[model samples]
Target: MTFPRVQPEPVYRNPEAVARAVGGKARGNRVTVHAPGHKKGSPEISILVDPSAPRGLLVNCFSGEDPVAMKDWVLAKCGEPEFTPGDRSERPEPRAHLKLVRRAEPPKPFNDQYLVARGYHRSATYDYTSTDGEVLFEVLRYEHPTDTKTFVQRQPDGHEGWLNGRGDAVPYRLHELAANTADPVFVVEGEKDADRLASLGYLATTVPNGSWPEDLSVLSGRTVYVLADNDATGDKKAVVAIDRLSGIATAYRIDLPGLPPKGDVSDWLDAGHSQDELEELCLSAVPIAANDNAPPGKPLSIFEWTVDRFVGEAPAVEYLVDGVIPLGIPGMVSAAGDTGKSFALLELHRRVAFGSGIYAPPIFGGRVVSEGVSVMITSEDDANEVHRRIAALDEKGDRFSSAGKRMIVVPLPSAGGARAFWKEDRRLGLIETDDFKRICDQLHSIEGLRLVTFDPLASFAHVALNEDPTAGQFVCSSLARLATETGATILTAHHMRKSKAPIETLADAREAIRGSTALVDGLRLAYAMWPADEARAKRTCKSLGIHYQPNRIVLGGVVKANGAARRIMSTYARNESGLLIDKTSGLGTSAPAQDDLRTALVIAIEAAANAGAPFTKTGASGLFEMRERLPEELRRIAKGRLDALAAEALERGEIVRSAAKGEKTAKWLDVPGGLFAIGLGNFTTGAPR
Candidate 1:
């Protein structure tokens, strides 16, 4: 029996084949094409297919069109069925990653008559040579009679003829650059600047138009100094050069001060700067290692685990401060402005460095698990401020008395400007500055390093931190890497978003953090502080029998932690020295102490009435509510206790609740005869019901 002829399935999964079928241009595994139904001139769709990628077929629409619909259109044009857009089996083999190689094309001989015909005079010619000194291309500078200058490039053809366009480009002095491996190389924007520096006996090279060369591996392990012109474009090109040379060499972008708006190194040299002065600037400039942001170019590998691998016990999570901030991880202490966050962080650093046993209470009631060396780099506080704060934190001068070298305070403002650890670029997002690398290197050199702190993250993390999650990730991940590599807990003090609402819950505390949510999510631990609301604050002060001060009381705790942890909020009072003292542990518990607190509350209410800012019976507005006047020590006391105290006072007539004149909704607390409630013989109350 003869079988019917079977038709083969159409293959629309190959990006190049589909692109060609749709009249699109394919370069390597990616292709650009216009949407199948739209006019063909404007290509807005990009399709990429590679078996090695996690997803073999990828499509993008540039004009804000639906990518799925665009992909379907492309597939339909390639003779694919409506239901076949999800198919991926026909993709090409995995593309191999290759290093860039220099490829030069033959050039035609120079045409001197060509420039003369255009009313141009040849001023200078710069030759771009190969590694062996063979001239590959010549860039000719031309000037018109009107003083207008322009440059044109031509390369030599095999027949000694010249071509108009530059052939495969190389560094201006390729042979010398490749041979002189010891001398530091300077890269400028144009050949003229390179030539100017070369005339001064310095090794210098440059690429055309301030662009990079085809290959730069020859400068591996060398020191490269990138010199920028005075223009904004020059600044951008210097950044590009630094980014490209990051892994291959130690690079520094040296700005020659006192140049004209569009002047260059040649102009700076002509201004009478000595070679020794230039060398001094280059030597003093910090070297930036660009490779810090480069990706690990390793191939993906999958590992198989067996049951036997689980036989051994896993390591326990270690902590720098037990049960609070974990060791070898990144954490943040965030608070609203003037909430004493800097003071709190500095105290924690001081306690950990000098051993907290000297202090009355530990940080967040969590004991320091590791006590070695702690380094604090502060951009917000200068040396004098930090010194005063250290003295206040250690009234006994313990910091100087014991383990003198345990703490290192680096106030960036005093040193110079507050050098940012990470700088945001319009194109590159966040890039690590040389200051960060230098600090890391110094930290690594210190023995027994346990902690490093960056005060007020906004000053150091120079980015649009609140709007960008990637910027948040870059900062946290960079700190995490440093922590993991150095076995130290990296802590950063950051400001929380300003909100009038009290942080009653841990979730609310997390929400109060200033930056992107990713900032908190990226941390292994996050502690937050916020002002206690009026009700909560008064209730606390009443129970503690302490005077209430709104700005002096704050509630804080570990809002986020990687593992199961005690997430309870703790109350702190700003002491005379601006240090936050944990007041929850100091609450009075005896019945006599409770009577004294209630009596103090009654007197406080009478004083408020006499002062004209009468205490309200309840509610947030009007004169401050009863709860708003509570002290920090009474924070842990139940709210019902205050309510019961108010009720008993009303019953005994020690304090009478009277509505203000012409206001029926609001009730004001007033003492009878305006006499002190405790001094009067009418006070009588039992334990709160």
Candidate 2:
């Protein structure tokens, strides 16, 4: 049978002296004979093994053939070439062993004594235990000698692991947490912070792995406040914990500000934040679920809608302009650019606030319920410009100064300050936000507020006005609710499309309003203003003998009157004083003579006949053309008065009209003795026939 190679035991001469050698230093002629298959390069054995006298040590110790066989065995073990017995001085240095020594086992029930004995004099121990008071793990945090920390846990068979040998460890202070189920649990990243918070009288706990627990079901149905350490890892752990505990508990993250990197709750306490302040901080933490802040409600049955529930509630329809503009409903005024829409609305606001009647024909009987508070919220005009407009309107002698605090003019924010009223994350528009609510609340505090106006609605609306009908409706609905809740009439100014052609009738003006149709459909009332026919305005100015400004003529018409009259048109002219006045009642000066009206009608009819189309008495085209030929003063008179002028011209035979062939066709027209009698052939004479 082949024998297995065995390392011989090393012989030590003067063993006591060799054993007493420290760090390769020895005395008393000591020698060591290493066995075959034994490592010769070990530093521990090198002190006794001198290479110069290897034969004396081995041969002197082992006689006969054993020394030679041992030498060959040692050479084979060292992986050196075979050498004669006398060639020891030329032998190579042997290789050293590479195997590591076995580590010592740590003591059980590690305490302050074990820590002190291991050079961890200044250290803290935190024990993580089961509900039955059995210790599962302990974390030792060393502060002195060196800054280091370690985790240790005992196993079921009395063996120890760095952390827990079992699966995952439970949270620190599991027993205390079970004892106080009603109190809010404060979760932190580590056991030290947990213990620090617990000593401060807070119910604190942490995971044993020094990270967020994979499963946070232990905190189910409890309010949890996670104090994140001021570091990336701590934030990550807190976020994970929050996400895991979302539906299971009302979890909130508390991040202490002004902390150093890697700072923790202990550091916050060290910085002198008291328990009361910490509690306040915890209270201020935002809940992980945003909907948690919403008001609670129970489901209601559809059958709850009964007649008695609404029969006793008959809300009377109130109005700012009687039938035209109903109170408790949103209204809009749309006008083309440079039409003085803002000035017109401001004038209305003045009228409402000072209880002054409009100089023009009354749209809503030109009366208010009473002199009451009126608010004008405008984004187009600044405070100074608004004040200037108000001051200019006050020139009408209504004495708005006497109204005192009733008139509230608010200039909205401009670019940079302006934010979207409808954000993607919120269901409420900016008008319903807390900022606007405070505004409304303050205005509602004023007794008898009759009207609130938003000049240029597009400025306040942040959504795509033309694309999003729903957002438009939402804004209108919000305004309507504001009106209904506060009993104030709300009017918002809007813009109309610029028409290449002049707006002659109310229908044409209504069609010119800009934006989605919802703007008009959602409101109870809407009004439109556009530039009147330039020819008609100029003719009216000439008849009245007043200098005409083309832009000064504005035609105001009711577009949408849900609870009121269908068509109410008014002619407004801005005078040299910059105040819009009612020109439909005729100019401020005297009226033109009857003969001049007839002469003007004959001239227009003869001119129409000369062209392909003849003049018709009732046709709009014929009337518009005839009015264009008339003097400015006559054009200012209402349409009824102008029609009467045409009838008188026909009765006196100054002009004659034929029957119309169709609805749009104008009746044939002729002079008493044909066109020649009207001096068309003798144009140089410049005289009537």
Candidate 3:
């Protein structure tokens, strides 16, 4: 209760203070709030009691323009959400005082990309973040207010978070429990049912997962039977809603066709249904919705060039795809060091420009095609340096491909007189509209320019990526436009940011990029590379084995690599040798490609291990057990030809074991001995902090 003093004194009044004081506001009439001892200096709120209610109705006239507000709103009372409007000062009869404050700013952007799109299917979960200056904290709580009363918090283990909301939070597992619940299990959207389902002797819970949870430990105890909402309908929404959770459990949607239209299971229970009716509904689970968007046909190769047509290897489909050549999305490569950066670009330039067949092969020392490819070197490297690299490529041209793949490299002039707000400043801003068009004409003049490569993204952008927003937008837009307009495949490289750990993430290209997010956000296909384990990487060229030189893989490299030592054991087939020769001098003691399994494995075991950390008798014995236990295909004779190659790797000192310090055992990764998992330790110095 707030009583305005007959003679009021201005002490302190702001939005927050007013909100605390105002219990209610009534317009037009000055209802004399009768409070005792109304002094000018000290004011009190008079909470009108509802005698029976433990707390009284907080009384205060919140400020507002009765004329400005709607009639209904002018009469409404306002109060805080979590209010325990403390006791009224006993000195005199008090009146609750109230006032208003201006509105706050709009909410921040959504954190997850998944949430940004419109469909949530089963449920839409929100992620909350609490930051205290330099430190950032994240929390995922799916306490659906709709039915939280029935849901109770439980003690949790392992995950980083305050399970009961009582302790300071660590990392939270808000989605669902990853327990061993036998085969199939039933899952719901809210916490209450998930918890209750487990007790009802059914395996279930509010699946906390927004995306498909890959781990199946949760289904250890039961086979899954995903029970979807009884209300959702339609071809697209229903299927996606179910498809998103296809693997967790075999889907079985609850069929509520006989109940009130759109009535949920909770509604049925609320309506006082007998036990039998509820049981019947649960048993009548329907099949999950069907999927209609099947995958597109696989492309023969991820990358393509013009010759792929006559060459017989390219997809050779009659119609060409505009944005991402359907399955032919070529990988884009980048490097931090300038040498690696330019070399990578030059290699691609040589490959597509001349079609000398860089990765394409036998077709050329590289491969020769009918016409040359066009390359737009927008990167800011010195034009002379680029010329020199091309000269080197040609000198080694004999070492690369026999194909006369010529590239017309056009360097965009670094400066311009006055730039077209949206154009590349190749002419130092000197070009008029006609001049820019002529530049395009000259490029078009090149007979059948098929691929373009951009080096050092920094040089291409006229403005600084961060500070100059307008320039960044213009440059990124230009690259995208050129790719579309020219019809020539465009491949450009951007510098990868410095990371404390190795970057194995497939789409990590987009995140570490320095400039506007637009650069990667606009690209069709992307690939990322970085040095792997530093401990082992330093040993790459140590001569521990015969073939331990720093070689490239998928145009990416590990900062450090862990490999076993091996030699060039004999090969069985002839074609494989054709690829191994140094295309430059075209000189090498080439060997057969295919050798049977036993011969290959025998060679590897004898050679790959290092004297630095050679496999002891104990280690060798374990490997023998492992080899014996391998599936039928991994055995000596029945093993496919590929296994024979792996066996040969063991024979030749090709792979060297970069024995990790203090490691008694190491897990096998896609690469020999990369990090065991995403969050595991690396480097001898320390683990992830």
lDDT for each of the candidates? 0.73, 0.63, 0.38
Q: Best-fitting candidate, measured by TM-score?
A: 1
- The best-first sequence of candidates by TM-score reads 1, 2, 3
Backbone N/Cα/C clashes per model = 15, 10, 99
Better of 2 and 3 by lDDT: 2
Best by lDDT: 1
**Model 3 agreement with the true structure over 493-534: per-residue lDDT tens digits:** 667777666543323434655556655545554434444333
Stretches of model 2 off by over 4 angstroms after superposition: 1-316, 357-365, 395-402, 413-419, 423-447, 542-545, 586-689
Question: Distance (Å) between predicted and true CA of 567, model 1?
Answer: 2.7
Please report how far candidate 3 places residue 197 from its true position, in Å: 92
- Residue-by-residue lDDT tens digits, candidate 2, 610-660: 443455566554565456654466567777877787778678766676533
Q: 347-437, model 1: which lDDT tens digit per residue? A: 7777778876745665764678788899998887888998898878777777677676898888888989688889887676677876788
**Per-candidate RMSD, Å:** 18.7, 24.0, 25.8
Q: Estimate each model's TM-score.
A: 0.57, 0.45, 0.30
